[model samples]
Target: MRCAHCHEDNDLGLKPPPPKLQGVMRKGKMPSRAVATDQSVAQTVLAGKGKMPSFAGRFTEEQMRALIAYLRTDMPLPQQ
Candidate 1:
């Protein structure tokens, strides 16, 4: 399933609830570790881990950078 599927409303009742990503960028407390660097987080998104599936080719380089940048911000990305 997609990230929004679990993160959006976040009432799916799945075991091991998916993380709420609203402030993950500012928090730097991803399930993996503290002080998550942009490059390392990008690697996790691209490679996936455990239950999360890989998205290796789903995004262009530009798009990937944009995603990372969005996650790095303290504010929520403005609505599309």
Candidate 2:
């Protein structure tokens, strides 16, 4: 797995930190939720918000979809 933003190849066993959103949770911080499918994730990636920058210009629609698919299965769950 690699970082979608940085493109650094992360070891398969290593887990990445969760994305935090201020004011979205009662505690003032929230972890990003999954989008259910690769396509949905790609759309969200293209239409970024908050701390997530849009990938519209950086990657094509097909590349975004591939990235999302990598995130869905290869990336580890957030730490507890």
| Top model number, TM-score | 1
Q: Write the per-residue lDDT of candidate 1 for residues 1-80, one digit (tens) a residue.
A: 24566555445676787666667777767766645677777888899877767889987799888777777775544432
In every candidate, how many clashes are there? 0, 0
lDDT of candidates 1 onward, in order:
0.70, 0.46
Candidate that scores best on lDDT: 1
| Candidate 1 C-alpha error for residue 12, in Å | 5.9
Poorly placed runs, candidate 2 (over 4 Å) = 1-31, 76-80
Residue pairs whose backbone atoms clash in candidate 1: none
Please give each candidate's TM-score: 0.73, 0.45
- The TM-score of candidate 2 is 0.45
